[model samples]
Target: MAPKDPLLGTLKVCVLNLQSDGEMVTDTNPHLASCCELLELVLRKGLQQPVISLVHRDYWQCFEQLTHQDPCGRLSALSLAVEQTRVCRKLLSAQGRGRYLLRLALSRKALPQFITHLLHTPRVLEWYSPTTSILRNEEFVEPFMSLLLVLSHMEFKLNMENCSFLDESWLLPVCETYEVVPCREVGMALRYLSGRVFVLNLKPGSQAYVDKFICPW
Candidate 1:
């Protein structure tokens, strides 16, 4: 993060603030909203003018379009990552959709992977100008990505069920905090890879069953 670049400078400050707030960030966390807004700014910066009036410069919209193109299976991979959000029937406006998707990505610690896929898409890459968008500039892009990688290691515990008002407001939802525990301890663990689903059973010492899990009840 360069001290000279305004976005980077602000972002560096926000991340520093996050460190003081601990590793687990919730929607109520002030720094969490700031960071998400900054990320939105990064994606929407110097965007190419759109011919469609309804089409605004939103990170999720761009990512969704990129998904349609499926560059290097990057879009496909992340499509699965966010499929839950995509099927969210509550989100009405693109703004809500974008915010929800962004938050979900952060919670899942998949923001870096999502951005990595977007960068690989040359066609969608042109939507952002190298001069204005950090994701486009060859020099800044690397550092920008590195910053996202840093975020990936942190824990985000956002409330996915609080998306009812997303279509109308930009407010961050109340993030729920839960005790630290392994996914397998919850009785079910889902892992998707290359379009394949792997299910983990909860019983201690139980082996992960591949797409063949059945309720023992």
Candidate 2:
């Protein structure tokens, strides 16, 4: 048979290193190592090829399995990986495939649980800031922010009761910031979320005016 591809081999090693318990091997570089392998796979085989597609699918499957086994640990691993600019830029800039993969990984059935976890977990939401100054300085907040964006695009209904963590007082300020400067993906996400908030008639207290402020166009 043909000699094994180094990048593929590396990817296999990384996947195997992810223990069934939802933790990754501390010694392994999940982001750099996985990103390098992904980049190589995309460059050499292209995303449509059977081999590359299988690898991509398998990588996500591993994450999903781990997530099901241990939500907190899986989110921790994902947060760590996405904090790397190289990994974030690659995943966020790949013709939107990164976003697609993320959406797929957090299927509708799992989204409510994930969002609930995000809100309840202090460490996970620590980076979420209502202040523009704080948000601007925070570099590791993208993964958390990206999840909200993906959730905005989901088709299924969200349980309003589970959304108690979404304090309107704080969310309003964050939404206002997005409206003024428009942070691309974030702006879109805010817009979508705002629309949903209005449609759902979720009480936003003083932030109810957000419905009028948001441009429907």
Candidate 3:
């Protein structure tokens, strides 16, 4: 069920649903192949959404299996997937989902190349327009930010893990500077903006807190 506009977010949700349900989407028929590619891109975008908690679980598992089957090729594909995830997270958080999708479709793998190619793509700059109302609500903000942090840590060029280290006794000042603005932004919505932060423990209490804070829908 495509929306009236059938923008990228809608397409991504559909594709994720299909993947989660184990639908046989592949690159066999030309049109279907294109659809698979589109779905892949959408999944990349969905990685940035706030609603899907296990963003990389299934995809990464499938990718791991693919790599085990063909280590050489699948590794490259994995790298590309991670890069796309980073790009998608950056675009979605800074911009909006529709705009990010349009740019993603145009710029596909614009990371290792020239940023000029990315800038030249349509809808890339459209996100900054004051008139560009968010197609999706801002509830996606937390997930978007959390994914941005994670993806920023795990991208192709930056193969680092996330380490939460709060610059002791400075969170309030930092939040005071960045969190207060004209609009109710994500920075304001995040509850820990005023606290000493550390890598959220995923075992128990901290894990539950992280799940509440960063869990994708």
Q: What are the per-model numbers of colliding residue pairs?
A: 0, 0, 7
Model 1 residue pairs with clashes: none
The TM-score between candidate 2 and the true structure equals: 0.22
Tally clashes: model 1: 0
lDDT tens readout by residue for model 1, 112-132: 888887887788888887777
* Whole-model lDDT values for every prediction: 0.72, 0.34, 0.31
Worst 10 residues of 3 by lDDT: 163-172
Error of 1 at 68 (Å): 2.0
Which consecutive 10 residues in model 2 have the weakest lDDT in total? 164-173
- Candidate 2: residue pairs that collide: none
Query: TM-score for all predictions?
Result: 0.71, 0.22, 0.20
The residue-level lDDT of candidate 1 at 80 comes to 72
* Candidate 2 local lDDT, residue 73: 63
Candidate 3 per-residue C-alpha lDDT over 94-178 given as tens digits, one digit per residue, 9 for 90 to 100:
2232222222322343322222222233333222222222213243323333322322232121111111111121011112122
Candidate 1 residue-wise lDDT at 202: 43
If ranked by lDDT, best first, what sequence of candidates would result?
1, 2, 3
Off by over 4 Å in 1: 1-3, 52-54, 71-77, 173-217
